[model samples]
Target: MSDIARELNLNPSEELDLLTKWLGRESTEHVRRIRSVHVANPALGLQLVWERLEESYGSPEVIERALFVRLENFPKFSNKDPQKLRELGDLLTELNSAKSEGYLPGLSYLDTTRGVNPIVEKLPYSLQEKWLAKGSQYKEQHYVSFPPFAYFTDFICGEARRRNDPSFSLTPTPSKTSIQYPKYEQPERAMRNVKRHISTHKTDVDVNRWTSQSDCSSFKPDDIGKQCPIHQKPHPLKKCRGFRSKPLEERKAFLKENGICFKCCSSTTHLAKNCKVALKCSECDSEDHVAALHPGPPPWGTENKNSPSQYGGEGEGPGSAVTSRCTEVCSRGQSFRSCSKICLVKVYPKAHPDRATNVYILLDDQSNRSLARSEFFDLFQIKGSHSPYTLRTCAGVTETSGRRATGFIAESLDGKMNVMLPTLIECNHMPDNRSEIPTPEVAQHHGHLKSIAHMIPCLDPDAQILVLLGRDVLQVHKVREQRNGPHSAPYAQRLDLGWVVVGNVCLGSAHKPTTVATYRTSVLENGRPSLLTPCPNQLQVKERFSSKIQNATSLRSVRHDSSVFDDCNLGNTIFQSTKDDDQISSSTAPKQSGTSTQ
Candidate 1:
């Protein structure tokens, strides 16, 4: 559904002017697309014009009733246009202020009225009126048009009725004599068709392997005599005749029940194969699709739209993803290699991600906590006090541990979670590239986590750190908001550099750079953009030539400024510069007494 434009008291022409300059050419184009009679006729506000466009199909009576509303809401004004006042009086009279035989008092409408159409005899009277209104709209929008009376009659009486009652099909019920043929799929064809289906199912994660064989035992020559982990047979159990002789279903059940490797079915053997046990539906026990992927919502409540649509699964622009809260886009910055360990961030808790951001998060592994400095926690949450419980590391170091590592719970780089503390303790370090804790992964009970056994190992042994996670406080992964970024001009345009302190003018000029590539659709953010000026090619060429001539003459010990262009040939002599504005009018200055410069 389209968003309803907000109500505005301004006139349409005024709105169009402001929006054209403020919103741009693209917005003006969209305004042109608006199909409201008030847009060009009465010249209502854009908001009211859009609202009027949403009016359902109806007869002239609908417009008459709406006119009364517009009249009722009007306040008494001094010296209003006489023409508008007369028109208002005329509208009230046409709406039957005198209460004519066919009209209701105060412009109330009857749902049973059908103005002039009889084809809608079976349709509800309201739908009949709407049908006529749609025909009227089509007539207004097109030069040549025909009334869709028969079409609307069928739509209201047949298609709509069938939709309201699925069993109400217009086709006659088939006789019992009819037979339906069963469709079958060959093994090769079915798998090929599955590949085609897979193309449309977009996903972020790629499957690393199609099958697993974790239960299979080692097949090394030194462990050849080891007992099979599955059937307890010897290692390299490919020679087992009994297991191979079993039926497919029996073998599947045996492998699954015995904890044998389902892919290769080796109790103590090698791996790499497929499982014949097709995935079964939990609801029906049928070998087709899984229960989770089953279509339709649970037969509970219609409000539970968490299930995917019966046809298209998720991954369609998040267009229908439980759209209640804002999920703002946060771009990743590029990795700074080694010169800089800092990753800039500006997060807003109460507003959108694109909203102005003054808060920041910079990476400094040399320090303790991840986001802000140690004093940041005390300044924001605590008044020079630490918590009672001291945090200890895997190596039993509590030197930097504050009893209370105060953290705040808010939407952050990782997700919405508690990352603030009363006091921050120094954490360990890791590589530039690290994995994101699954966003759904919640915080484990901190009471149960006391030592190294409860912590995840850093890939680098020397850089072990206590990485935290939780729903209340999100885990900090390597923020990629700067990934493949900080290099492009447009991407840098998004940043507000109020907090940035650059001593070097090379980093960012003391004066702002001139805007370029501006167009009609450009949005004004910080300031007005000046129209781009073309480079002065003639002036540049003349300056360079004058400099060359002067240098040549100077080398020959000549000291006359006017003689610098004496040796140069020219098609026409360029006019000399003048400081006075009035002297620059009309055309170039008249040729001087003896100037050879061009």
Candidate 2:
């Protein structure tokens, strides 16, 4: 017996379990070997195995073994018999269901059999149509003629619809199957319309004569009997056909009469190409040359009464003449006409003279104040020292004449001179009828603090520090409010002594608080003011300095002339300054009041 039979004990349940486990692990090769050994009597061999299975297990087990044996041998005969192939497919479907349900013995036995063709060829007509249209295997294997396939597909689709839903009915009952011919109304209408238009526009003109194949000259010169198509009358000339070919000479003459060519300036002849008079240039050896072509004057040379030489005059060298000579004036003693009456003289000193005068003192008191406040001059330890800086100022006014008038001035900054003007800041207050105190947040609001922060950069590039000395309108309002309230101190006393820091610079309050410090002063003014007084104590400085303001000012006015003195405010100073020693010196400076002449 087999090892599985030997392992089974006398107990039926244990024996059956052992046999089942042995069968589950059986290899396909062993099954094939058994088949080969009984190849002469395959049916007998299968019955013997079934009988053995029945004795060891039961009828159901015997039936299953028989099925497995038949499946194993089915592949061997499937190519010969379509019925066996179909049977094998049915057996595989059962095996697949059993395997899915965890019946391992059936799975093992079924696995030994190669499956039959899985294609469902014998499906119902409706199913076949659907499978042929949409199934992947059917698509790969099947082909059908257009008419038969389409007709059958439509019929099967109709049947499938009825089967899927009994209530579904064919509209007006399905027609008998037949080939469909498409109606072409659009093409028919287009043809009819084209024919109607052509017929409506038809004329009696002879197309053959209009597009005659005869040479143009072959037509008779005077054929008055021939009628003109345009006039519908006989030709004007005795034998002319009305259509006349223009003579070549006349065409050439017309071109020449209009000055179309340089050579042969005649109205009735061809141009130089056919004239034979125009010659090629001897110098450039080019055929494009026309008669009387003259070389013009050089672009940069001054025009003279005498004609320019054919070889180009001596002044007209190979390159530009203007660039070879000095055409620009120096920075001094050059005068510009401002108007019909007044002229502005440009100051250009002869080269760099010895330090004759201090240019720093020449700037206005406001400029001095700005210079004193600037950290660059302080960092260089050059405060109060005369530094040569460039000062540029631009001024404009809109007069009653409705025109914008402008003026500009540029000067070297020397300490002795001052470009002065009145301070633009003015303090004004209007009375109020009601009183209310503004919270700090409300005071800090951007709109309320307009005057302090709204100052704009001046038009002059040299005016480094643009100062708007306007009264704080917000503070004025607050003061009036305080005065109206009962049991309060004076409006001036009630005013806040706060200053706002915008970016790196601080803007001081303009009014309400009567006492305030200058940007360069550490102590409050205490209602004591001087027009051009130096700060007693150094400024209460901050960590960040406004480099944009400083650099713009430096490039504009300070660095125009190179000098040891000009190095005073040449670099960034805000983040570099450390102590009091790096502050501008305290010295009362003179004041002047006038706009810089620009």
Candidate 3:
């Protein structure tokens, strides 16, 4: 069934514009006439124009092919009067609106008639009975049933009665008479065919194995198992039947003889008790031994030894493997390795308004916060307080107490939309090659993007990405309109900044990279993101130490007091200061002993 419930709000002219703009050099007579109509009156509804042209030019399949578009208009009806038809259209429109807005649940195959029945009951009694009778006839005739919306649409189109005919039903007809066929006596032909199929299947399996082996060539010889451990055969140790057949005691002996860890069963570097690798016996939930060497009794309701329950249910236990987090000041030459959505925008620095330049801004909806290069801060001399943040990326978690700069203003090239950025965390620089950045020349190469190619700016080799806008600044990246083509083809999306081309725009091997790279960065803490905040005590201590260091470094010359004559001058000064304070206190204690005598 067609997706008739999908809402199409574009007017007739806009639809024609979409067809002509992206179809590119494939305008036929039917499309030309449609275009003429669109140019004449751009405010007409879609149904009105389709009604005029659909009869003269059947279906306009050429335009659909050129644009790669599918338009499922409400099916037409005959015999039914205009009033009831309009009411049905309104009801369908309401149902579609509710479904699109998520107020009503979508139709599923298990019971397609559930949500739609109540809506149909709101119609006239005669229409309801007619619909129900058609549904009963349909249920009796066809094994497969249309979705409720599609069924209603088919009924309106008068296909309901015709569909119940035997010719239209998919179910097989009952035989009127018995018939028989002679069987082949020779079994050799059947055996030969089966053998041929098996050989072909084996050849395909061999090819797949070769491909997997070639891709996994980077794996260590021991890890991939170049030779079986038990018999030294050219196969993985797990596939060695001799080792697997060995008794538990003998297996333990073999492990000790080979100096392999009992827990991991593969590692020879450490003993079982000292091994840090996270593994547990599947049979016993024991972390002490490998699953292969399981002893007799099956223990039920036993908790894993490495479970968090063993450590007060707070966090991962000591034996549990963890991704260690560390702070990085700046990361250079980190390849994005994939097609990136980028837009050109002007950034105005609060301190140096004259230094505003067009910067390539990467839009990542996966990221929750925005980031800018550390060098960008230095370029504008933008100063901000330190804010500690934990960044999680495809590589691993990284901790940074980086500066968060504010007072930066960004605007589209057209100057239509402007955003005052409150904060931008200092992250890292773009890769050196920057091959992932889409250029106008490459986008224009594809026919689909020819019309909008001028909207994309020319490649600026010297331009570096200064800011990466994440979901926090999603308003700037909201799609106003878009033009697209078939699968794997480049498409252009119009954002507030302007049109940006994304997808596999490269057509030749010369432009394609040797490897595929992908990276996603997000802020995560306990499976959720936490805010970046500065530590007050740490900031105060840092400020005091920095001030002292600045003062010490500024001194032009140093001299020791000649009268002191102490080798350890710094220590002696501290000691003498204490001694002088003691003497002053002793001298100031006026006649306290004499007063006590009275």
Candidate 4:
């Protein structure tokens, strides 16, 4: 023991040194015997070691060393003898008060089978505070399991109390007084008493064991299946013979054969009112006799009633059709009649001006030459005229006519010309009329001189000026020349007029030279010309002529004539002669002649 103690650095005289030497022996049987003896008298064994340590190393150092060894081996010995925990607590308290070389090592003991309790409660309040503070620091340094250490500490303090108290013992106590047994009744009473005692002891042992055992190992028997203690039967209610005798399906079939609900089996093909099994529908007041109750509103009566096609039916009241029609009328506008004659006679005639005949003119401003005539009548109006004139046709239809007697005015500062086509302008003027006619108002509004002036700037500024007057305005600005005298009005006054003739006009076959008689006639009344005579000589001839000039040579000449003859002859010769002249002329002439001489 001394040599082993020397090797382990334990004092030779110390009790722990001797115990360590004994514990290190190779014989397992001897070691087991020592453990058993320690278990049987753990308090006595602890006291013997403490006494030996005091004799060898003095009380203070021995107590300190004992505390370290006890804590070190605590895990090994704690379960072997429960009283060992009380012995350890006592030693720790003594070591904590004794003088030591350094701070006492923090001691932690874990009892794996126990739960947490207040063992520190048995400690002196000051030592408790000291250890608790030390415990906090120790917990920071060590990774000990919680609750186990706490339970062990509680058990140690409790056992310490038991050890200190004289009345406390591990052994059972006997009753202080006993009742005498009757000699004749002893055996039976003994048997009864034995039974009673057995039961009482069993209950006491259970309670005592329960108090000592931790929550981890505490026994619980109630987790088993239900039992009837009186009859010793398992699942008593479910096993009842009456409930198993008839199947639910059989009951349902039997009741239904009799035209009754399975639940109550009353008449009316439904369960009786008193039946507990009957289910009531939440949606409607009707009960569900065969199926579970459905949850929403009744399907039949809940459709929207305001739909159009549905308004004449079962739930509809009287006068619904009239009310619906009135609603439609309020939403839509009122209707009116649509007829063609109403539009033509009343609407169009009221809105548009009366139709008048159209006239065109041809002019050549470079030679100061121009031809002027009314297409249907010989009457003419010239340019620069303030007043308009009238023309009459051979059919005795008299129409008030004028030049394209209006000038266009530019609305913008830039003087942009809106040279609208005749058809477009006419349509605009008579929006309600079907026939095409150029009214005076339309011509005046559309033909502005400013628009014409703007067009002059587009031509070469250095180029010589030319003026062309339409036949409707030709007489007013005509150049009259003497036939055989020098003192004649200059054919045309030379002026810097910025105007040009850009396009031609097409006169129809009905066109003829105008005459005074033709000018005064009204076709609506007479339906024919009053004068139907044709010219016999060149001076008196009045014939329709092409207005075009051929090449620049004829273009320089102001006036040139072809031939004028009577219109009496009507044959292929007349048609041939007309075609020959049309081919010879460098102009798009008017079409065939429709007039006759009578």
Candidate 5:
């Protein structure tokens, strides 16, 4: 005998008490497993529901085991079959030798949905007509379908009452019985609505096409030319035959409830599923796909003039695809445009793998390489040589006289292979205005760049970004303009519908955010930025350090001529100082603001 049966036979009352207690614990464990199963198989469609009273075909074994456990308490549930509303089912299951695949009487009593094959489905056309037209007077026994037992309806109504959904109607067709059952309308559609299932696929045009198939299945496209049976005129299904088929009262209620025509779902246009204005692709004016996924040659031509291939294929190289990897801050795939607000980047110290620190990097396709501030090295490590290197910034050449560092190589972790792949370079470190972290209050939420900008914006903060990468590290992307109208301006329009990312190499088309401000780098003859005076007021400092400020011409204005200064003459030694000797310096430093121009 089973353990449960043996226990019940020995001490019926005490053993049953113990069994019930353990059932509660076991049910909790079962629910956790079922919940995970439900999430994993979400496409199961109302199968593994939590509420046992509702549709729960997926969890039949669990329910049966629990219900039978309740039956084990003889005195507690000795009345009839012990399971409520399932005496007939339990007895019938005994005949099948198991619960599964057993015929349960009134099992579908509470369900309102009609399956594909109803009782009248195979009946001749004349018998179907007679049954609907004659009702009780019809003498055919095979055609006369009756409701289940009256108590079955009461149980179903009680279940509905417990849920408190008053409008929850369960219209059950009767089995063959002599009871005077009320007429129930045939279920018009399945429980799932077509409109509710939309957006399961991508694009609006796909949604419209989906609704057309499910909602307009009764009428065929070829029927458009056929004359309506009621009006004897060539008209849409919703206008004549379909409308006349319903009773006068139902017709009035339908018009009152649905103010629009059934064919088009429109008040003005009463056409079929085919709308008057079809969906057109914004790129090629074709109805095949959305502009983002348009497969044909671009509107202008196959050759895009703004193609980066012409500009020497800026950021892309031959092997970028195999080496590209993204930081953890990216919530999406690496191929799309997202906010640069939170990004993590690793910077090595002049080819030294041991001194690499993962820091924040704001993607700037406009700048040349990743960057680091002098303050960052204080917290992290910095391997710099006595040799000085130059840096070109958005403002201009900001590092004409800093020690040139090289040991670090920028790298990304290849998650699939468990290897670190090198990026452009160990970002060149520069002195900023302050060492203190920027206040979060001053940082406003910047919307995504609407146009393609020369920047990548993932910063690992948890700290602020020290690096701004230009097209050199990013995959190459190109754009072509398409006019909105026949007479629209050619240059005025720009779409974010081209150049998708593959690994790190940009290959195809995907939607990207717009660029508000792009970092444009060019080779030009300009002067270096100028320095600020020590005095708080410009006039006071200008008088005191007039000669000093003139000598510090590299601080304010920037120039392109390579006047390479040695390590002694360069850097912020002559500027104001702050906590931990901030290279950007503090607010007290002249020509130094809260923002980092680098």
Candidate 6:
């Protein structure tokens, strides 16, 4: 019982109580008294409960013991009536002997049973004709033969219901003798409209080829023993008919949902980055990713490059209508691009203040609560309490247990203001909104203002976004002023932390436009994140001291390299290794190289 409880994540005492309550209601009076008199092992108690039920109701018959009866008075048989005496003895012997079998038939009451089978076989001549015609019609329409004998009764019953035959009824009215009979229902109307999927294995294209056999041992692929994630069938995911049939984006989402490695197309414990199996894509012969997850144009032929259809002119195809509809939606302030404001910041752990780590943070005012990656906690040496966290996003709801860290400090690149960050929830993975870094070149396109272009920091393309600051950190979100631009132009907004450009901004013809679309994510926690800020007195004193000792200190002892403090430096820091028996730790940090980052 203890082992069982541990396996099921339950308490042993609770398991005992549940079994007791269940058995107490269904057991006999003697068994109930025995249960009340003494405590028994839960396993034994459960067995006794099931055994009692089996004895009473498991078998089909009610009585198993034979019975005997005697007459009160009878006439005496003499020598002259030997035949009559012999007949009386035989009757008495048969009555006194043990019974051969019970009155019940003990047969399964399925379509093969006596009740429905005889009725289906001996249907009226008109009904039989209709049933035969139905079978023949199905064979002709589907280009297949009639169903197997096992399903014959079902086919006849279905035809009978369709014709509304009074003699052959599925749900007959209940009579006194048939009170416990099961009421059957006809197949739903939707089932009739379902399209049949014929087997494509044996086709004219490959009929002459040798049959594919599972028992063949001569040829085995890399995914021979693996099962497909999409169809849940025993086949390679890339070779699955269902997987190859879906569009590219859905295939990516399918891999994420099933936790299959995109590089190898196999479900393994290690991530794609750590995957040792090397597979070359057949499409482009690229070893970076599997052919199934190729990011290039789809295998299906695209429009001709020289044709007007390629440029999406009027009346090109049905796609033009969809494109125009999307344009209208975009004109109405709806965004279809994935973008957000991501900036680098230094995070100081409470336990290790001197070892501040550089981390990229996404400033999102729409999120009610901030979130950090679980890796951030280990890297910063921050300890937190475990708690159940519920995250709701545009996609769906995700419930998982996470840790809450309340001790942390966030600082800007220029080191102007220092603020204590609010409580942040740890998540296994962040939202999918990877966009091109907002560089200074992107800010130069707008003619409204370019005076503070130098102040607009350039985000490195290789920086890994580790944290998201929500509105809960109220101090950083206070908008001081804004430089507005013309319609559909990106504008710079000044916050307490620094200046940030927002909206779609085109850099050049070679570079794509930057998309700053908002992805709203709400985090539900037991305790709300309280806004925390550093004391004004402390900041004033620190600022004054720094001004007085500007040139006094010559030899500075810097723990990290000078490039780490630069605005464009996105290299990950190699921290000291910490060995723990329970948790796995890594000294190096992750880089944004491919799809393996998430």
RMSD of each: 29.4, 41.6, 30.0, 53.8, 28.0, 35.2
lDDT of each: 0.33, 0.30, 0.53, 0.30, 0.34, 0.51
Distance from true location, Cα of 247 in model 4, Å: 43
Q: Estimate the TM-score of every prediction.
A: 0.16, 0.12, 0.30, 0.15, 0.19, 0.30
Q: Alpha carbon lDDT of residue 67, candidate 6?
A: 19
Model 5: residue 265 alpha-carbon error in angstroms: 46
- Lowest summed lDDT across 10 adjacent residues in model 1 is found at 437-446
**Cα lDDT of model 4 by residue, 484-587, tens digit:** 11221111121122122111011111223232312324322224545434334525443443334222243224232344224223431244233245465454
For model 1, how does the per-residue alpha-carbon lDDT over 167-247 read when each residue is reduced to its tens digit? Answer: 633555564322111111112322221222111222222111111232222233223234432233343333332333334
Which pairs, if any, clash in model 6?
none
Please state the error at residue 472 of candidate 1 in Å. 31
RMSD of 3: 30.0
Query: Where does candidate 3 have its weakest 10-residue lDDT segment?
Result: 323-332
For model 1, what is the error of residue 498's alpha carbon versus the real structure, in angstroms, after optimal superposition?
Answer: 31
Q: Write one digit per residue (lDDT tens) for candidate 3, span 1-598.
A: 0122124655555576565565435343455665566566655533444554555443434333322221123333443334445545554544444434542333222136654564455455566777787677556545446344555654544433433345745654544221111121222322321322111121111211112212121223234234434332355543333343345676676656545556666544456787687767776788776565665322221122443222221222344432211101011123222345787787886665444667888887878889888878887776777788998876557887778887888877777777876578988833333555666665666788788878878766436777888888768778898888988666788888877777655443222244444443334433443344334454222322222223543222223334433443453234233223445342344467566321
- Candidate 5, residue 27: the lDDT equals 49
Query: Which residue runs of candidate 6 sit more than 4 Å off their true CA positions?
Result: 1-339, 383-385, 432-436, 507-598
lDDT of 6 by residue, 233-265 (tens): 356766543344345777676555434566776
Task: Tell me the RMSD of model 4 versus the true structure.
Answer: 53.8
Cα-lDDT of candidate 4:
0.30
Candidate 1 wrongly placed segments (more than 4 Å): 1-279, 282-545, 548-560, 567-573, 577-598
